[model samples]
Target: MAKITGETRLENVLVYMANMGRELIVADRCTVWLIDEAKQEVYTTVAHGVREIRIPAGTGLVGHAIASGEPIIIEDAYLDPRHNPDNDRKTGYVSKSIITIPFRNNDGTVIGAYQAINKMTETAKFTSKDMELLSLAASYAGKSLESVMLHQEIVDTQREIIATMGEIGEMRSKETGNHVKRVAEYSYVLALALGLSPKEAELLRTVSPMHDIGKVGIPDAVLNKPGKLTDEEYEIIKSHTRIGRQLLKGSRRELLRAASIVAEQHHEKWDGGGYPNGLKGEEIHVYGRITAVADVFDALSAERVYKAAWPLERIERLFREERGKHFDPAVVDAFFAKLPQLLDIRERLTDKG
Candidate 1:
């Protein structure tokens, strides 16, 4: 039940299955290999004493099991020419008794294989009971792996859509090319420097691209204006924040929720002077506060239709000056802390004409 329930991450699932198979069959080592059909390769990350190994599909004993869709037990692996001894040669571990069991998805299509090396029992060879236990474990693992892989696919697709939507908004405002990309990278570094977990920082990077997604609704005249705007026109410009939040706030998805907070509050100032909600200090969501610094730094440092890119020194000075009054102090400190990384991101993703 634990193998098939409550685990969603592919890496975690692989570890669980590998550990269970090794303990149940009393083997020295166990490896769970997943077939990457697109690359025609099989890879394993949960192999004992191994970093990560990838080999051509059907290249070794494990691959043969996956390719032939059958289980095989070897009393002496060295006697079998089908066994790949390269890993053993590299790691100085000799293989003797082994069992390989192929696993399948709901459609009965072979998707992966489990290989356990060197039975730990006194016989030093796998018996019928060991084979049956491994086969049953493989069967139970198949559906759970498929479900987790499908969930990952959906998540990747959603993130792509969100990123493309961000690019579309940038295109609409004539701020075309790499601006959102720079901001996303910048936001990620800032999030990490501020002590967010790697997962949380990665989530911020994925959603930060959509920070300006509301700009899609602003009129062309206001969005593309190349001169100082009239007060009324400036107010119209500020409405993009609200427009962006409105577009994403309806979604209950976690990514969208974070994007909505960023869209709505990225313009808010630290001292209760910013527009829309005028949220002050920590009152604003950390995502929004982090993005505000990222978005502004990119906007100021990147060339725009209305203005040439400001020099790096000037931009840095402004950030220093605005540390507490216009921006979160901790976020600003993070920007300086990760300045080298942020500069590298800006250079790599620099806009091209």
Candidate 2:
């Protein structure tokens, strides 16, 4: 007996059934057709022996079996009015008998129809035992396809959530652009250049966008102010680091934890002159260091309410000048080396607004 196992491919299942226990199994051709509810049509997926055939629901024995969700056994193809002989003519193989069974999902919904044609040797017809075996095989195929679809749905939902959170952070900054995407891409490139593993690079790509999430705590007036910030206003703005840390503290998720570190230390300078705790050098989290370079690069090149956009030349100059003073020297070096590719990404992803 042929067994249907978890994670088995549909083609393998079909081949297994063709070879299992039946003496003249090699003489038959197998075909699978999936029903399209919206189109009211049946499409062929796999066809052997039979060239190809498609019929509407209730048009032929195959269609009738699918519509009625039952097994069909045709012993004399030429005598059956519902038999479509075009397929046999196309494949140059006469059909003596065919057994088709409706494949049902776990919810009892008919997912497709499976058919085995032209039983070999004696005039033996398809039996109840054959239908029962094929039905079991179809069930396993349905479950495997369902599992794959469910997994895709989960991945799509995660992507939507991440995109929504990034939008929220971008809206809080009063920066009318794709600042989040640009910074995230920049951080990813920088992480790769710094020799981090691929997984770490991807983590930084996603978490870097949340570095300014604490800006949500700042007042709208200060956050969207058009003029230069005063010392007092600047001090309040600087507190966003701690505010971000506080907001994200105690989370067990590694992404959120990394976001918290980035929020707190992205503004900290290489020389220890930057805000909140004034921690410097290797004291800063690597995520924070990478985000700092990315954030500053984007901010400099992007036009904001308070600052005009800097030319690429000037941006490169500032990075080189501030290597050890404002930015990590290693990160800065990597940024310059990969500047061309970064510029291409920035241009490709630039927001029209």
Candidate 3:
């Protein structure tokens, strides 16, 4: 119960509750079905040993429990008219005994159902006692699911806002939204190739799009200038990193903090020749180093207001030439290792005229 309620991710919460439901009911398998009220669908992802499934809100025994707000215990599932044997046919798992209990939020609204199949005991039947225990578990799971769903919604909204803000920054400098999308995907692939965990890699993907967010503060004249800039104008351009950092650094949220670091240090060179702070390799945050490679690659490959796009061969040659001088050697190696995925991203999100 502690672990189930503590989980902030909806998927994790569903898996934990499903495992708990199987144990509580002493069944061979359990599935936690969630109601997508807006879509009028009931879906289950952690269906124990079977493939995930989704159906209309009132389609099967589980859906009937949800709609009728009743707990059902059937000794022979095949004999029950409401039973949907299609899943059993698909998986080749015969179902004998079953228990489906509706779960509710604090308001007592039926949110979903818990279905436990094939009791493990000698009778091959779920008793009244089993239904009682499962009902108790379902009640707790309902509240937890509600909280986790809310958390997921908030996180998704935050990601959308960040991406939109990043796009605004890019658009100010005449770059397309696809530039940030490509960079985000490229950063994710590079992070994984460099041996970062999936969670860390996903974080990089979400925040790397903001690497040029500081450009939002740069004057349009200098930002869009086709001609080479004077030293003073160049200095002003360089300050975008600091400006971006300043805009995001104060946030207490981890997402924004990660974005702050990427915004400030994406231009920093491996040899300390780059950027607002000139922090060198290893000293620079990995997020910054990773974004630096992604940002530069996209900038060079895509057509921009000031310059034409470079050919793939020329861009590859520059990466090889720069090596440790311009980018962390490890990140650059990872970049090359995942070049195919990066190219696919470019193709998919390639700026549409």
lDDT order of candidates, top first: 1, 3, 2
Residue 51's lDDT in candidate 3: 74
User: What's each prediction's clash count?
Assistant: 0, 0, 0
Off by over 4 Å in 3: 89-92
Winning model by TM-score: 3
Candidate 1 per-residue lDDT, tens place, 107-200, comes to 9999898899999988899998999999999988987889998988877887998899999999998886598899999999999999999988
TM-score, every prediction: 0.91, 0.62, 0.93
Q: What is the C-alpha lDDT profile of model 2 across 292-331, one tens digit per residue?
A: 9999999988888888989989998999899998899999
TM-score, predicted candidate 1 vs. hidden true structure: 0.91
Give the Cα RMSD of candidate 2: 7.6
Error at 261, model 2, angstroms: 1.9
